[model samples]
Target: MLVDSHCHLDFPDFAEELDAVVDRARQAGVGRMVTICTYLSRFDRILAVAERYDDVLCSLGVHPHQAAEEIGGVTVERLVELSRHPKVIGLGETGLDYFYDKSPRDIQQECFRRHIRASVETGLPLIIHTRDADDDTMRIVREEAAGQPVKGLLHCFSSGRQLAEDALDFGFSLSLSGIVTFKKSEELRDIVRDVPLDRILVETDAPYLAPVPFRGKRNEPAYVAHTAACVAEVKGVDAAELARRTTENFFRLFDRADPSRQAAA
Candidate 1:
C-alpha cells in the first residue's frame, strides 16, 4: 500500500483524465491521496473531487505562492471553520517559497503564520512548502510554532540538514517527492537515507513532479511507486517495507480517514 500525500489532482493537467488518473493510482496500489488546495476559490472544487473519490482526501488553505491574493480578509479562524468537514484532513501545502517568489516575501510569511495558527487551533497538521528560503522558513516555523505544539510535514523537502533538524525538533514530519529520484538529488537522497521512518512520508505533488522514467512529463498519483523505490534504495530497505511505512505514516498523520469512516465512503 502507498499514499501520494501531496498532489494537485484539481489542476488542469489532470482535468481531462481525472478518472483515469485515479484508476491508475488504484492499479499502482496507491491507497490514498490528498489533493492540495492552493486557494480558497478552488477549495470547493477540490473538495468535490475528494467527495467523488473514495480513495482521495483534501486539504484546505492557500499556498504561500498565492499570498498576495490571500492577504486581505483571510484569517486563521476561517481555515479552522472550513476544516470541520471530515474530508478536509489537513491545513496546507502552505509555507514559504522564495524560489519563485510568485508572491511578496512578507506576504508569504504572513500567510504562513495564519495557516500555522489554524493548524494549531484545529489540530490538523500543516503541509509546508518551502524552497530556497530555508532560513526564513525555519525562523517563521520556530517563532510562530513556539509553544503551539503544531504538527506538520514539510512537503517536497529539498532543504539543508539544519532546517530538517529544526523541523524535526519541532515535531514535524518530512515528506519526500519526485525530486529524490533525480540523479542529481544526492543531497535529498541522503536526507531520505537518514530521516527516521516513523517521521517520514511520501508524496508526488502530482500533475507536477513525476519521478524518473516519466521525468519532465505530467506527474500522477500512479508514479509514486518510483519515489517509493528510490527511498527504498536510499534507506537500504525493501520497497515493500517503504510502501508499508509510508502508507502507515499517511494514515497516522491524516487520522480523520479512519477505516470505519472511509469504509462508509
Candidate 2:
C-alpha cells in the first residue's frame, strides 16, 4: 500500500469533506498519511485530525513562514513535550523559506535550529521545508549534524541538485510531491532519476501542488499515486515497486507511524 508521507489534513480545505477525502485516499490505495503542523498555535487542530483517524498521524512544528510570529512561544522543550503524544510522529515542516521571507532570516534559522535540537533530543524525524534557501538550509543541517546525527525527510522536495545531494549525503530522505509531475519539472525529474531509490518518499502536500491531469485543482492524498507514477517513470521502476519502496522509506524514517508498531501496540 502507498503512504502519503506528508499532507495537511487539518487545513480548512478538507474540513468540509475530510471523511470523503480520507475514504478516497483509501480507495486510491493510500494506507496512511501524516498531517503536518505549520503553526504551534494551530497544533490542536492538527492533533485533533490525527486523533480522529486511525490511519492519520501528525507532526509538531512551526513553518518557516510563522517562525517570527511563534518564535517566542516555540521552544525546544515545548516541541519535545508536544511530540510525546502517540500521534505526533515528526518535527517541523520547518526550515528556511527565503522566497516568502515572511519571517526574518535570522529568526527562521534560529527556529530551524531549535527544532533540530528537539529532534535530536526526542529521536523523532524532522519534516523539513526549504525554499530558495538551499545554501543556508544545507549549512544549518550540516552544522547540526556535526553535533549529533540528524535524520528526517525533505517534505515536498522541489529544490536544486546540490541540496538534494547534500540531503542524501546527510542520510535524509527526499519526499516527492506533485510538483515533480508538472510539464516544466524536467530538472526535478532528472534529479529524481539520479536519487537513490531507497532514499525516496512520496507525498501530496494536499490542498496544494496537484499532479498533472489534476493540476490547478485541489490536491489530496489520493493524488500521491500520480506523483509516485511519475517518479517511477523517472526511476525506471514499476509503479507498484515505487509505491512499495516509498512507503517502506516513509516508515523507516517516521518509525512512530510504522504499521508494525501500531499492530504491536
Candidate 3:
C-alpha cells in the first residue's frame, strides 16, 4: 500500500467529485492520505474530508503565506487543542516561504516556531512547507528541536542537498511530490537516490504539481503512484518495495494515524 503523506483535499479542485477522486486513489494503490490544512480557519473543511473517508487523515495549522493574517489565531494552544480530534494526525503545512514573501519574513519565522512548539508539545509530526528559505528553515528547526524530541517531515521537499541532509540528521523525514517526476528534475531524482528509503515519503500536493505522463494536468492522490514509481526507478528498487517503505515511513512519522485503520478499510 502507498500513502500520500500530504495533500489539500479541502481545496475546490476536487469538490465536485471528491468520492470518485478518493476511489481512484485507492484503485491506484494509494491506501492512505493525509489532507493538510493550509488555513486554520478552514480546518473544519479539512477535517470533514478526513471524517468522510475511511483512509484519509488531516492536519491542523496554517501555511506560512498566511502568517500575517493568522498571527494571533495560529497559536500552539489552538493547534494542540484542534489536534485532539482523532482524525487530526499532525500539525502545520507551516514554514518559511521567501519566494513569495506573502507574509513578512519575521511573521513567517515566528509562525513556524509556534507550530514547532505545538508539534513538540502534542507529539504530532509537523508537516513543513518550506521554499526559498532553506537557511532560515534549517536554523529554526535546529533551534526549536534543541535538547528536545521534535517529530516532523519536510513535505514536498524541493530544497537543496544540504537542507535534505540537515533535515535527515535532525531525525526528520523528507516527502517527495509530483515535482520529482518532471524531466528537468534529474538533480532531484539524484537526491532521491541518496535519501534512505526508511526516511522518505511521497505526496501529490493535489490540485497542483502532477507527475509526468500526467504533468500539466490537475493533480490528485492517485498520481502519487506515478511519483513513487519515478523515485523507485531512481533508487533502483521495485515500485512495490518503494511503496512499502514509504508507507512504513509515513506511519512512523504520523504516529496518530492507526495503521490498522487502513487495513480495516
Best by TM-score: 2
The candidate with the higher TM-score, 2 or 3, is 2
Return the top candidate by lDDT: 2
- Per residue, candidate 3 scores C-alpha lDDT tens digits across 70-92 of 88788888888899998988888
Q: What lDDT does the true structure give each of the candidates?
A: 0.88, 0.92, 0.90
**What lDDT does model 1 reach?**
0.88
> Which of the predicted structures, 2 or 3, would earn the higher lDDT when compared with the native?
2
> What digit string (tens of lDDT, one per residue) describes model 1 on residues 1-265?
8999999988988889899999999999999989999997678898999999988999998888788897674688789898999889998878888889999999999999998888878889889999898888878877887886788899998888888988888788999999999999998777777789888898999888789989999899999999999988888899999998888888787778667656776
Could you tell me every candidate's TM-score relative to the true structure? Answer: 0.96, 0.98, 0.97
Give residue 106's error in model 2 in angstroms: 0.6
- Superposed model 2: Cα runs more than 4 Å off: none
State which candidate, 1 or 3, has the greater lDDT. 3
User: How many backbone collisions does model 1 have?
Assistant: 0
Clashing pairs in 3: none
